[model samples]
Target: MPRENSFSDSEGRSLTPDPEDEIHYEEPAAEAASPTYSIRTPWSPTGHTVPHPFSASRRSLHSRAPHPIPGWQNLTPKEKFRITVRRVMAMHRGASILTTGGRVGAEPGVDPRRASADALYSHISQDCVIEVVDYSAVRSSFGRMTNKEFVNFMGDKSASQREPWVKVRWINIGGMSWDVIKAVSIKYNLHPLALEDVFHGHKQNRSKADYYSRHLFLRILCHELGDPDYSPSGHSAAQGSTLTGEPRSMSPEPMRDEDRLNGVKGGDVDEEKTMYGTPPTSRQSTTKRRRNPLLPTNRRDVDGMPKASNSASNLARLLKREGDVKDARKERQVEEVSIEALKQGERVNVKVSPMFLFLFRDGTVISIHPEPDLDFTVPITQRLRSRDTVLRTSADPSLLVHALLDLIVDRSLQVIDEYHTKINKFERRILLKPKMRTVRELHILSGDLILHKRTLEPIKTLIYGLRRYDVDRCAALIDMSDPANANTKVVGFMSHKSKIYLADVFDHMEYILTSLDMFTSISENLIDYTFNLASYEMNEVMRRLTLATIIFLPLTLLTGYFGMNFEAMWSVQNNSDWLFWKIAIPLMIFIIPVFMYSDLTRVFHFIQKKMVTKQAVKQYKRA
Candidate 1:
C-alpha cells in the first residue's frame, strides 16, 4: 500500500509489477522443427474431421516440393502411388528392394540406391525338385531328395568317407525357388552377383559364363517349338519337308546297310510278303490283328533302351549285349549327326525356357532349371544309368553338361526348321493372294524371328566362352590333377576332355547362330515383300479404275448434254438425225482412240515390270 511511484519491497521498491517480472511464453522445440502445411479448406464445427497424413494440403505441399527419393522425384501422382506400393512390397519378409543404377556393394540395411547391382529376390514359392546322381567308375546311386536331404548330403563329410571312390556328383535342381537357391548359395559360397544373375527372370538376360574362385557359372536359354499337325508316332515329318535345300524320297522298302553290303541297290523284299512265308493281310485284317491281345508286343527301341529277351535266365546277357550295341551305335551316330544332312519342312511351335549350370573343377555340376516342363536332362540321366554308355565310362559330370547343351542346340535347330517351313508357306500364300491380313501375319513372323535371334545370340556367346576356356588365355582356370590331391588341384578350371567337347558344342552353336541370322534376314525381306505386293496390287486396282473412267467419261458427258431439257442446252434435242450423226459418231471416235492411247497402253505392263524388278532385288538381297 505505498505510493505508486515510490513504493519498494523492504528496501523502497515499487509495489506495481515490473516489465521484467511478466511471463513470456515459448514455442515447443518439436512444433518449431516440424514441417507446416497451409490449410486448404476451413474447418466446420458440424463436420467431423480427422487428421490424415495424405490430406489435400499435405499432398499439395509434397507435389510442389522436391522429394528425397532419386527416382521418385519426378514421378507423377499415379507413379508415386505405384512406387509406394512397390516400397511396401519390398518391406515385406524375404523380399529385397532394388534401386535404379545401384552400385556393387549393397547390404541389407543400407540405402538401396547406394547398394550393389544385384537382382532383388523374394522367397515366396518353394515348389522345386532336387535330384542327385553320385557316381564313380564302378558304382552309382540316383535319387530325388528334399531340400533338407540335399543340404545334409552336400554338407556331410561322412558321405565321401563312406563312398571313398566317388569321383563325380551331379545335382539337378528343377524350378528355381528362392529357399533352395538361398540354401545352395550359402552351402557353395556362391558369388552374390552370380546368384543375382541366376534369379533374374528376364528373356533378355545374356548367356554368361563367370569363372569364380571355386566354380564356373553358365546360363543358357532353352527354346522348343510345338506343332500339332506332326504326329510323334507317325512317319518322320522332317523327312517330308525340304526347306533347307534337302531332298526327300519315299520308297515302299527301306534299304538296310546289310543289303548295301550284299551289292543290292534296290530292295529285294516285296511289301506284300513276310520273311517266314506268311501271307500279307488286307487293311481291315491288319487293323484287327493289331487289336488282338494274342499278338506279342513287338516293341522296337525308339530311345535305344535295353531290350529284354522272353527268357528270364538270359535276360541279363541279352540286355548287356543289346546295351553294348546300342552304345556303339549311339557313339557312331553322335559322330555322324553333325555331318548328316537334315531334311527340312518341319513344323514346330516354340516353348522357350532357361538352364543355369554351375560346374566345379572337382567334377560336380549343379543344374538349375527355371522351367520345370523342359526336361532335356532325361537323356543324360538315362545315359548315366547305362553301364556301357560313354557317360559312365568317362565318369565326368561335365559330359552331362555338354550333352544337355547339345540337346538344346539340336532342339533349336529343329525349331528353326519349322520356321523355315512356315516362311515357305507364307511366301506361297502371299504370292497367290495378297491381303492386309497376310501382311500383318508376315510382320508377326518377323517379330518372332527377331525375338529368337536375340535369345540365341547370348547362348552363342556362352558357347564361345566355353570353347575359349582351354586356350592360353584361360589355362589358369584348368585343373589336371586328381581332386583328392588338393596340392595339385586347381580351383576354377575345367577338365581337358570337357574343353575339347565344348569346342565341338561351340561349332554347333555357331551353325545355329548363322542359320538364325539367315532366317532373320529372310523374315525381314518377306515382310517387305508382302507389303510391296499389297501396294502393287493396290496400284493395279487404281490403274484399272482410271482406265474404266477414261473409257466412259466422254459417253457420260454426251448423255448428260442431251438429257437436259433446257431449250438452248442442245439443238439436237428434237432432231433425231442430227443427234445420231453428230453425237454418236464423234463419241465412238473419241472412245476408240482413248482406249488405244500410248499412256494407257503401257501402264499395266510398266507397273508389272517395276514391281517384278523390285521383288528381284529384294530376293537377291535376301539370298
Candidate 2:
C-alpha cells in the first residue's frame, strides 16, 4: 500500500497509488444519474431545501421538457411562438420593409456586424431556381440541385475548409434566392451589400463592378431576343420601354419590310355592327407598350446607387462601392401588369435581364441569370469542355470572364446585323416609294438601335474597370513593402494576359458602338429623305395643276366673247380667217415662256454662243 504522498514512476504505467486522490470516490453511474439542478436554493435558510420541478419529472436527466434555445427559457409560450414564426417567415419573404440586415425585429442585442438570417434564408422566394457547375483544368462536374441539396452542399464546403483541394468552381443561380445566396456567401465570403443588389428592389440592377475580400462582383444587363411567341407567367418586362429609355411605336411588323408595303395585314374581325352601327374596319392600333417601372434608372446597382461614371471615375468607384461585409434584404418588386399588356408583350422579342458574375481568386466564375437560357453560354462551355483550349490551358478565370463578355458582344453583333439588314431593305424600298408607315417602322427600328447602344455602353465601362484593376493589381503584387499590399494578393482576377485578350473585346465594343452610330445616322437620313422626296412630289403635282388652269382659263374667256347672244362678233359669223390660231399663237408664245423663264434664257444664250463659234471658225479659215 502507498502512503498519502508517494513517488510515481516515469514510465507508461505509474506504479503509485495515493489515498488523497478522490478521497470520497464517485462511480460513473452516479454521475450520469445526478440531478440536473441542485435540491437547494441559493438564498434559502441553512436547513431549508427545495427540489426543482423538472428534477421530479423523471429519473433520466435527458427526459426533461426543456426549451432548446437558451433565449427561449425566459420567454413565454406566445413570445417563443412569435419568434419562431418570425424566423420561418423571414425565410420565405423579404423584410416587409428594407433592412440593412441583422436579425430584424427580434433577438435583442444581436450583433449587426455578422451577416445573419435568424432563420437563415427565410426571405428566399420558394420558386427560385439554382444550378451549379464545378470544373478544373483536369476534370469537371455539373449538377442542378434543389435548394435543400444546394444548402447541404454549401454547408459541407463551409465545414470542410481543411480539404486539400484546388479547382475552379462555377456556380450559376438563375433566379433570386436568398438562401442560395446565403449559402454561397457563406461558402465564399461574399459582401452583404452586393448580395443586396442581387435582388435589389427587384429592379433591373445597373451595370457595375465592385471588389470585395474574396471576389470581384460584376452586374450587367443581358439583352436577349425573347421568343416571339413565348409568354412568361406573372409579369413581363417587354414593353415600349427600351434599354435606352425610349419607347418603341406599336407599328405592326416593324422588322418585316413586306408587311409595311402590303398595308395592315387583316386582323380586322367581322363583327355585327352594334354600338357605332358600322362594321369594325382595319385601323392602326396604338401599342400597349408603356414605360415599365421595372426599367430602373441606369445607375442604382445596389441600394439606390447613383449613375455609373466613365472609365476613370468608374474604376475609382469600384473601390468606393465595396460595402461593409454584413448587410440585408433582397428581390425586386413584381410590377402589377394588365392582361392586355401581357398579350402585347408576348411578341416583345427584345428582353433585357440582369446578369451577375463573381470571379474568385481560386479561378471560380459564378454566373447568375434570370433566364434559363443556358444556350447563351454555349461558346464558353464548349471551349471549356476541351482541356487544350486557351481558356482551360491558361487557368486564368479572366479568360472565362472575357469569353462571357465576348459572347454578349457577339450576340449583340448578331442583333445589330439583323437590324442592319432590315434597314438596308427598307432604305431601298423607301427610296422607290415612301410611305408614312415606312417612317413609323424606321422610327421603331431607331429606338431599338438606341436601346442596344445604351445597354452595351456599360460593358465598355466595365471593361475599362477590369483593365484598370489589372494594372493596379500588378502594381500591388510587385510592391511587398507596404502593409496595404497584404490584401493585393487576394485579388488578381484580371492578369496581364487577360487584359491583352480583353483589348480585342474592347475593340469589338468600339466597332459595335461605331456601327450603332452609323446606323443611327443612316436612319435619321432615311427619315429626312422620305420627307424631302414626298415634299418634292407634292410640289411637282401643284405646278402641273396651276399650268392646266392657266391654259384652260383663257380658252373659256375667248369662247364666251366669240359666241355672244347679240351675234355682233365678226369671228363667230364669217370673218374667222384663221384668226383664232393667229391670235392664240402669239399670246401663247408670250405666256408659255413666263413659266419657263430659265429654259427660255438658256436657249437664247445657247443660240448666241453657237453663232460666235461659227464666226470664229470662218475667220480662222480666211486667215
Candidate 3:
C-alpha cells in the first residue's frame, strides 16, 4: 500500500483545507463511527467546526496522535494553544459524560438544536435543586433557584454585576444533571479539572485543595459514619492579585460577561439586622466548637476541685454579685447540651459523598453536594438567615468554608461516636457471654472505623493547606489600609478572622482522627477478647466432660461385670437387685471420691460464691 500525497476525506473532498474551503465538517477517523454527525464537532486543529456537547473521542492524551490537519505546522503558537485548551476541555467533558451517562443525548422526537441546547448543561440531575445565598455584614439573602432558570439566571442571556456589598454568593446544587454542571461551569468558569473532581472523583476518598488561576478548587469526602482510597493530585498556580496581595479567583478560564452577574435572587429579601449585634445562642455557639467548656477548667477552687473560677474579680461585684457561679454553670449546661447533640443523634445509614467547594476571590462559593436531592448544608442556610451569627457579618468566603468543614467534622464526630457506642456494647457482650453474632458485628464495625479513618485522614492536608498560605505559594497578604488589621495575616483561602475558624476545623480533624484511632484499638482488643473468651469457655466445657467420663467409668465397669456370666450367676440373679446396690454403692463412693473429689469441692465453692454476692459490677457508663 503506497501513501497518498496528503490526508483526504474518505469522501470526495480532500482532508487538506483547500484555499477555497479553509474549514471542513468531515469527521476524523475517531468520530466517523458515531452516527451523530450533524451535531458532532469536526476534528480541526484550527477548531473551525461547531462545538459538540463534549470532545471528539475518549482517547488518552498520551496516546499516539491521529493525523494532524494539513498546514498545522505553519500555524502560530496562539492558535495552537487555543486548539490545545479546547482539546483538553473536550477530553474531560467527554470522559465525564461517558462515566456519568448524563442526559446529554438528543431526545428521540425533539429538534436536535433544542436537544443540544438542553444537553449543553445537562449534567444536573432530575432531582437537582439549586440554592443560592448572598450575604454581607448588614443583611443576607438565601433562597432556591429553579433548575429551568439556568439560561436566564447564569447564561449569556443575563448580563449584570453582582452587588459589591453582597460579600459572598454561595450557589449550591444538591443534584447533578450534566446540564447544570456545564451551565454552572460556564457561569463560574470552573476549572475543567475541578469539575472532573467534583463530579467524577467520588472514588477519591482523600481531601485536596488545588489553587488554579482564578479560584480555589477544594474537594473533600464526607461520610455518614468512609472509602479511604485517595490519590492526591495537587497543584498551586501562582496567581497575581491587586495591591496588598489579595488572592484572585483561580477559575480555569475567564468567565463570560453574563456569568459575572451570578448572585442570589432579590425576591422577598428579608433583610435582617435582627439583633445582629448579639452573639450566637449557646447551642449554635457550641456547635462546631472543638473545645468543651464543660470539661474541668484550669482554675482550682478552695475545695481543690477544678472549677470554672477560683475567685471572682472585684469588677464582678459591680457587674452583679461576687463569686457568681450561675453564669459559669449556665455555660457548662449549654456546653453539655451541645456536646451531647454532637455525640447522640438519630442513626444515619452509612454513606460517603464527595463535597466540592469552589471559592472565588469575590467571595463567591459554589458547592456541589454528592447526593443531588439531600441538602446537608441546611444548617448553614438557617444560620445565614439568622442575623445573630458572626458568619452573617463576614465578607470572606473562607469563613463560609470553615463553617462548612466544621459542620462536616462535627457530623463525622457524631457518626464516629455511634460506632464507639456500638463497639462498647459488643465489648460488654463479649465480656459477659461472647456470641458469634456479636463478633461478626464487631468485625463489621472495625471495618467501618478503618474506612472512616481513611476517608477523614486527607482532611488534615486540606486544613493545613488553608491555614498555611501554601495553596497559592504566596506569603500572607496584608492590607495596611485597615489600620487595625494592618498587622493581621491572611493566609491562603483563610482571612485573618476566619483563621480562628480554620484552627477550630483543624482541631476537630485531630479529634476525629484520635477518636477513630481509639475506637479502632478498642475494636481490635474486643475481637481478641472475644476469641480468648471463646477458647476459655470451650476448654472449660471439654474439661467437665472428661472428668465426668473418668468418674463414671468405675460404675459402668460394675454394671458390665454383673451382666457377664459367672459360676454363681443364677443364684445372684435371683437375689441380684439388693446385692447389686450394696456392691455398686461402695465402689461408686470410693471411685467418685478418689477420682472427682476436687471437682466436687470446686463446684460447691462456685455455688457458695454465687450465694453471697460481694458487690455489684461497677458500670462506668452514661446514666
Candidate 4:
C-alpha cells in the first residue's frame, strides 16, 4: 500500500494532498470508490458517456454542466438540402471549421462573438479545428437532466445558451412546407420578396444587390417534372364575357368545307318556324299507322302488298347511306388518335432547346436558351450537363448557382462575339454601298443609317454588362499597346500578340461609329449641296426668263404700234400687204434695242463685282 495524504474537513475526515509534497497514490477499494462525472463523446453514434475531465473529488473546480450540440428542427427539406450542400462545399473549399470548445467569455471590453459569421469562418479556417459534434448524444443528455440542474450546468455569461461562437453549419427539417419556410425566414431575417422569388417558377436571369451581406439571395431555372398537356382550360371561356368580337364556341374539330356548305344551306330556312315550334304536324298521329313497303324490306307494308322491286331499291339506298356514315365515323376516330399521339410526342427536345440562367447575388435574373449543342460527347450536352450532375450529387444550391454564373459569363462573352460579328457585317455593308450623291442616294444611306442606330442599343447593353461585370475581359479588349514595345515582361507577355482576334469586335465598333459619323456628315453636306444646286438652277431660270421677257418686250411694242389703227393706217393696210411689212420692219428695228439692253445688264453685273472687290480690299486693309 502507498502512503496517502489526508486532511480533516469540518463535516468529515477527507484525504487531501499537500501542495509541496509528492506522494504515491493507490487505487480505492471496492467498498470505497471515488465518485465520477460522465460526458457524452461528440463522435459517438450512440449516446455513450465517458468520464468527465475532472474526477468527483475535483468536481468543485468546474461549476458548469456540459451542453449538447445544436441541431436544426424547424427547417424545410429544400432548406436542409441547401444547408447540407453549403456545408460540404465550405468544407471542400476549406472555408469553414468545426469546433467543440465552449464559447469564450466576454472579456473586460470585448463583445462575445464579436466577428460576423463570415469573419468567424475565416478565423476557424486559419486554426483548422473543425469538430463534428454528436447531436444524438446531446439530445439524450437533455432528456435526462433537470431544468435547474441543466441551467447550473450551462455556466455563466460567455457560456450562455446563445453563445455566438458555437456556429452550426448544416441542419435538417422534416420536409419543405410553407410553415417551415416562414419559420426559416423569421430566424434568418430573409427578405419576403426573396422567399417569394424562390417559390415563383419564373426563369429570370441573374440579379444583383448593391452589397454583399449575410442575407444574399439568388434565383435559378431548373427542369421540373410536369404534365405535358397542362393548360389554362377555363381562360377562353372567361375571355368570352367582356368580348365585343364575334362569339364562338370552343370546338375540338375544325370546320370542314361540307360543314360550311351545310351551314349556308341551313341559313335559308325560315327561322320563325324553327324558333317557334315545328308548325303542329298536319297529319294525325296514330300508334297503329301502316309503314310503306317501297322504302325497304325492313320496312312494313302499308297495304298487305309485297312491292318487291321498290323495296329492293329502297334497301340499296339505305345500305349505301349506312356505309357512308360508318366511313365518316372511322375517319374521325383516326384523325383524333393521330392528333393525340402527335401532342404526346411534342416534348421539349433537349437537343434543340437552349436552357440557361444567369444568377446574381441579389435576386435580379436573366434566362436564355442558346442554340443546341453540336457535340457528340453527350446526348444532352447543352442542357447544362456539368452543373446538373454536380447539383444532383451534392444538392448544393450555391455550387449550382456558381456553375450557372460561370455559364452566364460564358454566354455573355458569346453574345458579345455575336454582336461584334453582326456589327462587322453591318459595317461592311456600309463600306460596300456607294457614297451619297443625290437625295435619292442619301435616302438609301439613311435607311442603312437607321438600321445601325437600331442595332446599337443591344450592343450598348452587352458592353455595359461586360464593363460592369467582366472587368478583366473588357480590360483585355482595350489593351491595344504593342507587345514588343512594352517595358515590363508581364505587360509584354500580355501584349505579345496584337488583339487581331478582337479586331473584328474593335474594327466593327470603330467602323460603326466612323460610318455613322461619315453618314451624318455626308447627309448634312448633301442637304447643303442640294440647296445650293436648287439655288443655282433657280438663278439660271431667272436669267432665261429675263432674256425671254426682254426679247418679247420689243415684239410686243411693235405689235402695239401696228394695232393702233388710225384712219391713215387703215387706208394704207387696205391699199397693200406692205402694211404688214411695216409692222415687221418696226419689230426688227426693236431687236437692236433688246441687244443693247442685254449688253447694259452685263455691264451692270461687272460694275457690281468691282464694287464688291473694292469693299473686300477696304476690309483687308482695315484688318
Candidate 5:
C-alpha cells in the first residue's frame, strides 16, 4: 500500500480533498479482473450517447448520520394540538379519557383559582351524583336537605325555625359532582387544592388526609365484605330518611325534611326533637334531668340501694325506681347479635373503593360515598337512630368521623382475613401439589396487596401528622407553613378530638401494612417453592429412567445376539429343533439379575463405604 499525500490550506491547516476535486484513474492491478470507471454512458434509442447520471467515483450523499430538523417551532398551533391529542389518546387506550381542565394534571403549587369552574364541573358530572344530610342537634330535628337548603342553613346564623340551636350538622353526599362539590366548597370555605382532590376519587384510589384552615379532608380506601356466606340476622330493612325520594323508616315521631320544607307545622318539628329523648315524657319533669337536686350530691344510688340523702321521700323514690327497673328487667329478653355483624356486612365480596370524608371544625361532616347505592356506614346510621348511642347523646361530629375511621379499618382487617384464608389455601396446595395456576393467583394477590399498601401508607402518614399536632391539646397545631407540607397545606379548622381518634386508625394501618408485607413474602416464597418442586420432580423422573436402563441393558444385548442370522453356531446349525432351546437360553439371561439381586445390594453397599473411606483419607491427608 502507498500513502496518499495530504492537502492543506494557505494557513497550513490540513483539509480533506473533495471527491470532485480529485482526478482518479484505475491502476493495472485494479483493471486485471474488474475495471473501474468514473462514469458509464449508455447509447440512446437514436444511437446517441447519453451522459451518466451518477459517477462511480463519487460517494453516496445519503448518509446514515442523524441531522437535526426544526420540529415543534415549525408546526402550527392547531397541528401541534392535534398531534398532542392523538398521542394522549394512544397512550390512554383503555383508560378513562379525562378532559384537560381545572388543574386535573397540574403540577404541584399551581394556583387552583386559575382553574375554571365549568371545566371542573364538566369533568365531575360524568360519573358523580350529589346527596346531602342535615340535622339540628339541639332541637334533635333531622331532615334530608338539598344543596341549596344545606348552604342556606350553614350560611345563615338566624335560620333557627327547626331548632333554637344547632350543635352539630352532617352533610352526607353520595357520589361526586363537580358543581355540587364546588358549591359545598364555597359554602364551607374549603381549601381549593383539597377541593380539587374531591373530584379525583376512584381514579387516584389514594388514601390521604389533608387539613385546611376550616376543615380536614380524609380519603379512606375500603374493601367490600370478606366472607362469601356471611349474613347479619335481623338486618334493618331501611335506613331512616336521610334523603328525599328514599324510604322513611323513622320511629313515627322523627321529623321529615318534606314537612320542614313545606312549612307543614312548627309543632311537628318540635315533636321530632322529643323523639331523640326529652326527659322521659310524663313520668319525668320537663325541667329535670336524670340527676335530682334533692339527692345527696356526694353519693349515688346503686344496685337498687337508696341514695344517702337522709330523707324518707328520697328513699321512697329510690324504692319505686327499683321496683320499676325490676318489672322492666322481668319483661326484657336478651337479644344477641354477633360482633361480626357490627364489623363485617352482608356484601363482603364487593370490590374495593375510596371514600372522601370532610370533617369541619364546626362539627359538620361531609362524606362523599363513591358507591351511591351502597352505604358502608350503615352501622353508624343504626347507632345514630338510637337515642342512647354516644353519637346522639354527645352531639359531637368528630365521633362520626371516628366511627367512620373505625369502619374503614375494620373493613381492611376483614379484607386481610380473606387474604389470609387464600394464602393458607395456596400454601396447602403448594405443599400437596404445586401448580402454575396457584402461583399465578398468588402473584395477582400480591399486586392487590401492593395497591392497598399504596392507599394505606399515605393515610398512615397523615394520621401521624395529625397526631403530632396533638389536636386535643389545642396548645399546638400542625404548622401548615412547614416545608414538609409543600404539596398540600394543613392549615385549617380541625377537630382536635377527631385527630386524637385518628391515632388509633394510624396504628391499625401500620398493622395492616405489616400483614401485607407478610403476605407478599409468602407469595414470593410460594413461587420459588413451586419451581423447586418442579425441579425435584424432574430429577426424580430422571433417576427412575436411569435405573431401569441399567437393569435391562444386558438383557437387551443378549436378545440382539441370539436374534442374529449368523448360521455358524455349531449346535444351532446341526439341529434345527434346537433353535427353540437356543432362544430360551438367551431369554434365560434375565435370570442372572434375579440371582444377583442380593449380591448387587451388597456390592453397592461395599462401593459406597469404599468411596466414603477414600474421601475421609483425602481429608485426613489435607489436614
Candidate 6:
C-alpha cells in the first residue's frame, strides 16, 4: 500500500516519488557552472578545418544580414522624429529636461533669465526640442518662473549644454481635466481659453493661436469618460414623490375618518375623569390638543386626539381633508425624489477621442496633419492596436504653443467637409422624391443644411493662413532649388503631389459650396411656392364664398318679401282665386319669352358676325 500525497505533476498526475529517487536529486554547486562568453570569429581560416571553396574565404566572407529596422524610410519626417524621440527618451531612466516653445528667442537686452529656454535653444541649434521637463519641482517652482526667465533658462549656454531630443508622447488618457489644464498652463504660459478647452476636453482636429500672440488654442476631440455600453431607462418617473406621505423608512399611517370623528369615544374617559377627580377643564384639554385650522370640524387634533363630528356633513368633510393630505404628501415625496435625481444626473462624464480642431498660433496658421494620420503608432504596439489612430493635432502641446491662428481655418475645412458629406447624402435622398411640397419639405431639409455655416468663415480665415504658410515654404524651397540636381527632381515631384492633394481638397470644397447654394435656392423657391399656394387657396375659398352669397341673395330677398304681411294685396276688392293665377301666369310668360328671344337672337348675330370677320380679316391680311 502506497501513501497518498496532495502534490501533482505538471500533467496533473499525482506524484509519489520514492524516497530513494528523491535522495538522488541534489542541488548543483554554483562554482561548477561554466562562464558564458561572446564568440569572436577568426579573420583567417584555421589549418585544422578544411575550408570549402563553395564557402567564401573567412577573411572575405559576406552574407546577407537582416536589414536594420528600416529607419525613416517608410516614415514621414515628422513621424521619424517622433519615433526617434520616443526611442531616445525610453533609454533614459533618471529625470530628464525638456524645453518647449518657439524656434526663436527674444531680442537681445531682454533679460536672459526671462526668455524661453526652448526657443533660445532651438535658435542656437536650429532643431526642435520635444524633451520632458522636470516635473518634480513643477508644482512649487512654476509660479516663480516668468515667461522670459523660463526662456532664458532654456537658452543655449554652450555646445556641452545642448540636450538630445526627448520624446513627448501624446497620452489619450481620461482627458486633461481643469486641474491638468491649469497645471499645464502654469508650466507653459498657455492661454486661458486653450487651458479651458483642454480642461473641458473639447478636442477638434486643428489648433489655434490667441490674439496678438503665439499662444495656441487647440481643440482635441477626446473620448468621454465612462462605459460606452450604457442604456437609459425609457420610463422617466414623473417629477414628484411617491404616493405615501410617510418617510421612506416608516410605514404609512392608515387614514381613519370614523375614528377621528368619534372623539375618543368608548375609551377610558372614566379613568381620565378619576385622574382629574372632576372632569378636566375644557381649556386644559384644548391646550393639549389644538386643532389644525385647515382640518374639518370632525378631524383629529394636534396630539392625535379625535374630535366629535356633529353631522354626516362634518364626517364627509373630514374624510375629504384626509384624502387631500394623503395626496399632498405623495406629491411632495415625488417632487423631492425627482429633484434629487436630476441634480445627481446633471453633470455627465462623456468619453471622447480626438477629432478635428481650429488651432491658433500668431497671425499665421496652417493645417497640421490636415487629414488624420490613420496609421500613427505608439511604442506599445498592443495598446496602439486597440486605440484609434487619428490623434487631433491639437493634442500636440508643441504645435499648440508654436502654431499660429490658421489652425481654426484648417478645422473649419474639416467641419465643412463633414457638413457637406452629411448634406449631400440628405439632399440625394430628398431629391429622390418628385413633386415634393417645397416649403415644409425644404424646411425639414434645411435642419442639417446650415449646421456648420457659422464655422465656415473662421475656417476660411485659417485656410488663408495655411495658404500663406504654404507659399512661404514653397518660396523657400524654390530658393534652395538647384535645377541641375537630382534632388530637385524629387522636391519638384513632392511639390507637384502636394499641389494635387490641395487641388483635390479645394475641388471637393467647391463642390460642397455649390451644392449648398443650389439646395438653399431650391429651398427658398419651395418656401415661396408653398406660401403662394396657400394664398391662392385662400383666394379661391373667398371667391367661392362671394359667388355663393351672390347666387342666394335674390332667393333670400324673395323669401323676405313673401314673409311680410301681403294681406292688403290679397284682400283687393272682388279678388277671385283665378286673379292670383292670372297675374303670376302672365308675368312668367312675358319674362320667359323675352329671355328666350334675347338669347336666340344674340347667338345667331354673334355667329354671323364671327364668320364675316374671319373672312374679311383673312382677305385683308392677304391683300
Candidate whose lDDT is highest: 3
**Tens digit of per-residue lDDT, candidate 1, span 94-126:** 111111111122221211111011112221224
lDDT of 6 by residue, 1-623 (tens): 22231112224322222223222123223211101001111122112211111111111013233223323254456544544443333222100111111112211211111111111111111011111221111110111232222222322134113123312222211221111222233323444344223322222223232331333233432222223232111112332211222222222233223322233445422212311122222211110111111222122322223343233334344456667867997898689667545433212222223332222222112111111222211222222123242112122322321222222224334434444454454455445542343334456545434433322323433433443354443344443455654354211111223343344444444554566566666556555655676678799999678656654554555455545765566534456556545555665555545545765698899999999999999999999
Q: Model 4 off-target regions past 4 Å?
A: 1-441, 457-461, 468-507, 523-535, 570-623
- Model 1, C-alpha of 537: deviation from truth (Å): 2.9
What tens digits encode model 4's per-residue C-alpha lDDT throughout 155-194?
A: 2224323333222111112112222233233333444344
- In model 6, which regions exceed 4 Å deviation? 1-174, 179-451, 469-500, 517-521, 570-623
Q: What are the lDDT scores of the predictions, listed in order?
A: 0.52, 0.52, 0.55, 0.32, 0.50, 0.31
| C-alpha lDDT of residue 283 in model 6 | 17
Q: Name model 2 segments beyond 4 Å from true.
A: 1-129, 158-165, 201-206, 230-348, 473-491, 563-574, 602-623
Can you write out model 3's per-residue Cα lDDT over 1-623, one digit (the tens) per residue? Answer: 21122222223332222222323345444222111212233445554533321222222234445435445576668766665565554333333322232222212221111222223222222446788788887878766765545423664332324766788889888865544565576556676556555534533447888777578888887755321221111111231111111111211111222222223144221111111121222111100111001111122222333243322221223224313544875687588556534432222235566788988877889888745554588888887887778788666788898888888888887777777677677778888887777767677667657777888899987887777765344332344577987665544655777777788888888988999899889878888887897788899999999888876787788779777878777636678477777877888778777777787899999988876653322332322
Q: Provide C-alpha RMSD values for all models, in order.
A: 32.2, 22.0, 25.4, 34.2, 36.0, 33.7
Can you write out model 5's per-residue Cα lDDT over 349-462, one digit (the tens) per residue? 534556788887666788877554436767876677676776677777777877787788888788788888888888999999888877767776666677667766676776
TM-score winner between candidates 1 and 4: 1
- Count of backbone collisions in candidate 5: 8
| lDDT by residue for model 2 (92-148), tens | 222211121211222222111121321222323343356565556676566677654
Error at 590, model 3, angstroms:
10
lDDT of 2: 0.52
Best by TM-score: 2
- How does residue 323 of candidate 3 score in lDDT? 30
**Which has the better lDDT: candidate 1, or candidate 4?**
1
Q: Ten residues in a row with the worst lDDT in model 5?
A: 284-293
Residue 103 deviation, candidate 5, in Å?
7.9
Query: Which 10-residue span in candidate 1 carries the lowest summed lDDT?
Result: 283-292
